[model samples]
Target chain A: MRNCISCQIKAKVEQRNEDLNAKLAFLTMPQPASFSDVVLFADDDDEHPVPVPAHKAVLANRSPVLRAMLDNEMKESLSGTIKIGDVSYDALRAFINYLYTAEVCLDQQLACELLVMSEKFLVQHLKDFCQKFLVSNLNLDNSLSTYTFAHQHNFKPIIDAALTQITASMDKLASQDEYTVLKERDLGLLLEIYEAYFSKQADTTMYI
Target chain B: MRNCISCQIKAKVEQRNEDLNAKLAFLTMPQPASFSDVVLFADDDDEHPVPVPAHKAVLANRSPVLRAMLDNEMKESLSGTIKIGDVSYDALRAFINYLYTAEVCLDQQLACELLVMSEKFLVQHLKDFCQKFLVSNLNLDNSLSTYTFAHQHNFKPIIDAALTQITASMDKLASQDEYTVLKERDLGLLLEIYEAYFSKQADTTMYI
Candidate 1:
């Protein structure tokens, strides 16, 4: 009986996932007959901004910051045009597509760009996604820069994960080019890393 | 390492589920400022149909029937009003909500109603949901009627499940009020049930 229930639930979940994926076609293949009520522009495109056509309700539903902007009869709500500053056209397209589909292909650069956008917009799920991507892709080369970026946003998960990576191989990390840049730009963060390293050392010593 | 990957995938699924739920708020809470481009009317409400405000993209995206209606410069596309036939206002709302959120609270009656709507609209997920609901809820009381309903729709899963239940307790099913109704309405289905029962009996006899 329990197995039957389990199988039922599994089937239901699979069906729902398929349905959700089908929903993404609305964004990917927007029929001209379907009305798009709003357009978003990326800040980097100053001369001829290519409008990313979207639905206001979708943007408002996905992000509270966007909801507030659209809800308050702000310039964006009245104009039906939202100009997203500090975002490249590709990142803006990816972000808006994610709003509709909740799926995005992320490289490290794109992940970093999206993580900032997610933080700025208070899109926690996207933030978590980007954070996980950064964490999983963390290595000696990128740990310092990833940690710095995570610290700027106060993302604790990425901070902790990156810190663990950094402290685990402090010897190799200290000799890297990015580590010198981090030490010069943010000595406080550098000191904190050393402190964490010694604290981890103390714990390991006590156990030994 | 395998456990870590499993945990990451689980977390990603949970985050996507949450993001999908958040998207449903657009259907539930439509701000006048958000500019809903279409209104849907339920057929059951003739006097003054409550307009279910929605987006064309959402409707067209969720169902191919709706997409065809809106895509070919149909009256629904031109007028921005869709009249959903043979559905109650509540069911229409629930159906649209499910399109946006991939979530619904289904009772037996609502599940039946949604199943019919799903079939008409070719919404496979909702049909699967309703089929699972009926299958799990199958018993002597509902098996005959459920089998009839499933037979009408050509829903094989529900028909097979109902057959299993009916054949398992043929004596009790034969004495029920619904059995007389099923005999009157669809004698062929009753014969099929008996045939299935005898087949089971033959299998058991062969084993013995």
Candidate 2:
């Protein structure tokens, strides 16, 4: 009986892994198969843009923004083409691929790009993914810039996380190059960091 | 710091749930949207079969048999319609939806139908799902028939589990109407059960 129960657990885990791999493979099948209903181009200004073929049903199902765009008699829906401005082809491809399979290889730049795209597309899952990645990878060097980016999007969790990182290293924050940029462009954010840092300092002093 | 770490874990769980929900909703978008490239008919013989609209990419990606059929210059491919014979409309819809979302509401009969279809289509994940369902639901009443079904497909784990159930209740196994059916259709399977029962009985005797 014990052995049978253990086998069931093992089989369940195996099936889960197979399910994930199958969905991951589903992402790869779209490129070469040529059944895609729509083509997405990155950076509409580029004279010769690389087009990524995708299914409208998949894109719409994943994102309400995409659904609204495709569901209505919009220019994109009429033309069977969507032109996204200010994104690299690789980032666009990665974003669309992530729609098919919730899998992406994230570096700092790609994560930021996806973060912006997810926000734009109203894809909360990808937004959460990119936010978590950015939050975990935050350090003194990137905290100020990340905080600014998060502030622009009003991503509260990321803002709080970045503020925590920034306030923890207030002494070194001023010496960083991003500190100068943040102070010049967004003095309010720098002030918020200072307020947070001094409040934390006061709390520590009271505790002592 | 501890609070932040706990928050991150909570956020991760939330993100995973959102991801799952997004994919689940993806399965519901094919109907009435009209973006599907192909339609599947449950049975070919019906004069007026209800069409199940589905993306060819999704169907092809999930099952190698479907992929082979769609990728080649076959009748189904050319016609952009697939006729899955001997499966009920509900079962076929659930099967295709499972391919998209990896979610299904299974009953014993539906599980058996899907198990056969999954094996036919070489979809191991769904096969595992149905096999586990049947194995967990196995009892003395259904043991002989389930064992025979598993034997037909050479599903080893289900076969072993059914045999265990059958040999444990040897008295009940012989009295059931399915036992008579099994004896007539496949005497070898019946003999194998008898051989297993006696072997187990001998082991108990040796232990004593």
Candidate 3:
């Protein structure tokens, strides 16, 4: 007799796994190298726009912002070309690939860029993915930069996390090169750091 | 301090969950109600086939048979109409929906029909899903007919499962109306059952 052990439960797990695998097979689209209705060009490609072919339906389905842009009789819709400014070709390609496949390899830099693009395009799922990556990877070295980036983008979780990290290690705060840069470039941001540090100290003292 | 026991492991699980959720979101397409490049009609809809709109790219991706029909310059491809014979309109719609979403609420009859269709289309994933459903739902009541259906389609798993169920309840088999019908309609299948029964007896005798 087949042992009535972990496999009995594993059978259920395997069934669910099969269901998701089928769904994924149904949903995942291979990058459309043909029959493309529109093309996207990176801003850096000025002399000749490097074209990235895509289906309008797929683009519109993934992003409401893209849907609006393509659905309306805009200049881009009429011309069949979308010129995306202030982005590298690599980032633009990854962005489109993620829209189609939702798979990307991210470092700190790529995550920041994708997060900004996800926000601008109103792809909330991608934005959340990037935010989670950034938050999980936070450390002393990148805390100040992440805090500033989070502040600029109104990322509440990242702001809270970066603030916590920055204030927790305030003993060496004044000796860092970024400390001088922040003091000179944005005194308001520097003062906010002081506020966070003092507030954390007061909270600890109260607990004691 | 937050408990470390669960959080340490939960953080990894949550990351994986987030990845899957994002992929699902990217892959789950809304039904293409408009801008469909191709239309499928059930063969029964002779005069005015109730058109089920779909994209060629999606159709081609899901089924190699559909891909071949759409990719080559055929009459259906030229006219942008595909006629699917020997299927109900409801089944055809559900088939297309499953191709899009990989989801369906199945009954025995529906599962059989879909298994046949999935096989015809060479969609192995859907074929396996329908086969598993039919195999799991097999019982003495349905085993004879299920056996015949599975036999016709050369579905080995279902055939084996139904055969096992049918042979186990040989005492009640002669009383069923399906047994009488099988005797009249397909004598070969009836003889095969006797062969199976005797073979099982010999095996049991050997074990003893």
Docking outcome class, model 1: incorrect
Assess candidate 2 and give its TM-score to the true structure.
0.83
Which segments of model 3 are wrong by more than 4 Å? A1-11, A14-19, A72-75, A175-177, B1-22
Candidate 3 per-residue lDDT, tens place, B38-77, comes to 8999997667779999888778878889988977688878
TM-score of chain A of each: 0.85, 0.85, 0.89
Candidate 1 lDDT over residue span B115-199, tens digit each: 9999999887677778889999997778888888889988898999999998988779778887888788889988998899999
Identify the runs in model 1 with alpha carbons over 4 angstroms from their true place: A1-34, A168-175, A179-208, B1-35
Instruction: Give lDDT per model, in order.
Output: 0.82, 0.82, 0.83
DockQ pick, better of 1 and 3: 3
How good is the docking of model 3, as DockQ?
0.47
Clashing residue pairs, backbone N/CA/C < 3 A, model 2: none
Per-residue lDDT of model 3, residues A118-147, tens digit only = 989999888988998999999988888888
DockQ of each: 0.21, 0.26, 0.47
Q: Which has the higher TM-score value, candidate number 1 or candidate number 3? A: 3
lDDT: the better of candidates 2 and 3: 3
Candidate 1 versus the native: TM-score?
A: 0.80
CAPRI-style quality class for the chain A–B interface of candidate 2? acceptable
Looking only at chain B, model 2 earns a TM-score of: 0.83
- Candidate 2, B16-121: lDDT as tens digits: 5556555444433344235778988898336788888888878887798998998868888899999998899989988888777666789888998899899999
Enumerate clash totals for all models, in the order shown.
0, 0, 0
